[model samples]
Target chain A: MALPHAIMTALLEDDMSGYELAKAFDVSVGLFWRSSHQQIYQELHKLADRGWLQCATVAQAGKPDKILYTLTEEGRDAMAEWVLGESRVQEGKDDLYVKLYNLSEDNANHLTAEISRRREHMMQRLYLYEKIRRRHYANPVSLPVRRKGVFLALLAGIRQGEQFLAWCDEALAMLGTIDEPVE
Target chain B: MALPHAIMTALLEDDMSGYELAKAFDVSVGLFWRSSHQQIYQELHKLADRGWLQCATVAQAGKPDKILYTLTEEGRDAMAEWVLGESRVQEGKDDLYVKLYNLSEDNANHLTAEISRRREHMMQRLYLYEKIRRRHYANPVSLPVRRKGVFLALLAGIRQGEQFLAWCDEALAMLGTIDEPVE
Candidate 1:
């Protein structure tokens, strides 16, 4: 259900081959959602089989036929239904947080290490967002509303990254004096 | 691994029955981490079998024997190793962002609904944080460092929740006008 929704939504803009869809997802959808190339190809076939997507095969020089997918009217209805249907937030199931909880209860020293690792990880994400923003600026999409929303989302990600990094620093600093007698 | 870490960390504070561990997770650890009771029990058994945790059975009236779990030195060692290990940020993992991305691309109307759902969810989380904060103020823990850190985390959660809810309102307003072009 998730895969088809993504596929249909992508097709609404324009028809794209499986490879092309995967690449776009990497650049655009990849920011918010991710599906492997293998998974995308598999879903393409499924959508085509279900009549929600129509495929046009174009032969490339010395290469396999590339099937491009487009959304049908039925697919449009499906997307509309999905949007209006009973929506629910999938609870965040974070393993790292769970581990942190354990560390917090047991060992302060262990938590310090985890905080260090998590801070570094957040820094990496901040970097990735910068790259994505630069790419978006270079090749502007006509949908400015969508682009603006994405930029805001990117800001949120950066904010969150910084928060985690800052939290790590604070946690580490506190650790130094954690066992020492309070001043 | 995450589950085991959570269980061990809980034990680090003091040996706790599975039920108490779950409640502690919900009240305190839950500010940043989350886990289900079933998962906690399952991980406890696994950790004990692996010699990473020591368990003591406590008699209870009108209830099954409650097993109290405590982390072993080896478990602490493992937790230390994990905490100090390199942090890897798993990218493209957020479902809500992905959904928003697709919504922006497909239709503004759909994005509105998603934002609405997020606003409500954040408000609910805000309430939960408030309840926890009040309880923490009433009863205290041994480690002042941990107590302060937990409060800081709760504050962060509250701020983030407020920001998200506010963002949703702004987004909805923008969507409302964007869809209706100037006459």
Candidate 2:
């Protein structure tokens, strides 16, 4: 359900071939709304069937026909109406927390190592988010209305990424207090 | 798969009837790892079938027999091995982000109001998380090994709750800059 809306939001940028949209999703939209390429293609067909998207096939002289999708008026109305609706707080089902709940002195090292691995992943993502911020959001407060929405979404990612990384460091420190020296 | 592990983690505190486990999950463990009561009951059956849990039926006079589940030695082994493994960062699929991406002056109020509602919900959760921190973690650094894990998990909730609230405020501020006053 969210995936269809996610695809529609991406189409707000411009009409895109399914392949181009998938690429765009991976590079940007996927950062906020994770969707597999296959899911995107499948949703594209469904959206077109529902008349949320208008699809066209363009023949080429020397290449295979290109399929493109554009948001229909109905799609824009759907997206607009959706904006007014309540959004569920997508609670993260972090297995790490469940793993931590089972922790004892005997297995502390394993969870600690896992936290370190997670920290690296968080660090790399924080770096990517910041890069996007610097490149696109110099004056986010001044961007046009729709662009401001994009900036706000990116800001959500940056703030959460920073906090998540900080929590990793804090978790390691707390674990250190009770960690036994390896023999 | 995670629900099974999540159930095992809950059982670490004590063996419980499925009813008690479901209640416990709703109040505490569900905060970290969310699952429906139906899903929890289903996973309990699956785990018992896999020999990770032992289900015993104890008869009560003039009442239905109570079915209790205890983590087996194999369950402990599974939990231990699972702790060493990697955990995926459960990136929240926040539809608000997609809604934001479609922002325009016409629909600005709709999204702005949606954010306000989200902020209130987030504030209430943050307050609850803080309440738990105060009640259990008087001296987090000195807690026993296993208890330290519990504190850390709660700290994750507290930390993320605070950050999400901050982001909501920042988002509103950014939106405020361009919002047209309704006549």
lDDT of each: 0.66, 0.84
Candidate 2 residue pairs in clash (backbone atoms < 3 Å):
none
For residues A19-100, what per-residue lDDT tens digits would candidate 2 score against the true structure? 8898888657678788777888999999999999999998779988879999999998988888777778777688888877
Instruction: Return the top candidate by TM-score.
Output: 2
DockQ of each: 0.31, 0.75
How much of the true contact map at the interface does candidate 2 reproduce, as a fraction? 0.79
Which residues of candidate 1, in runs, are more than 4 Å off?
Answer: A1-3, A62-65, A93-183, B55-57, B62-65, B92-95, B102-114, B130-156, B178-183
Which of the numbered candidates is closest to the native, going by highest DockQ? 2
lDDT of 2 by residue, B1-183 (tens): 488888998887689888889899865777888888788888999999999999999888997888999999999899888887777777767788888888877777778788888889878888887887888888887777787888888889888888988898988887777756566
Clashes of each: 2, 0
Give the clash total for candidate 1: 2
| Candidate 2 residue spans exceeding 4 A from truth | A59-65, A180-183, B59-65, B180-183
How high is the TM-score of chain B in model 1? 0.75
Q: Candidate 1, residues A1-183: lDDT per residue as tens digits?
A: 356676666667878999889888765656555679999899888888888888898989998889878888988787666755555554444444544433343456666666677777768777887787777744433447656656556656766666666666765676555563344
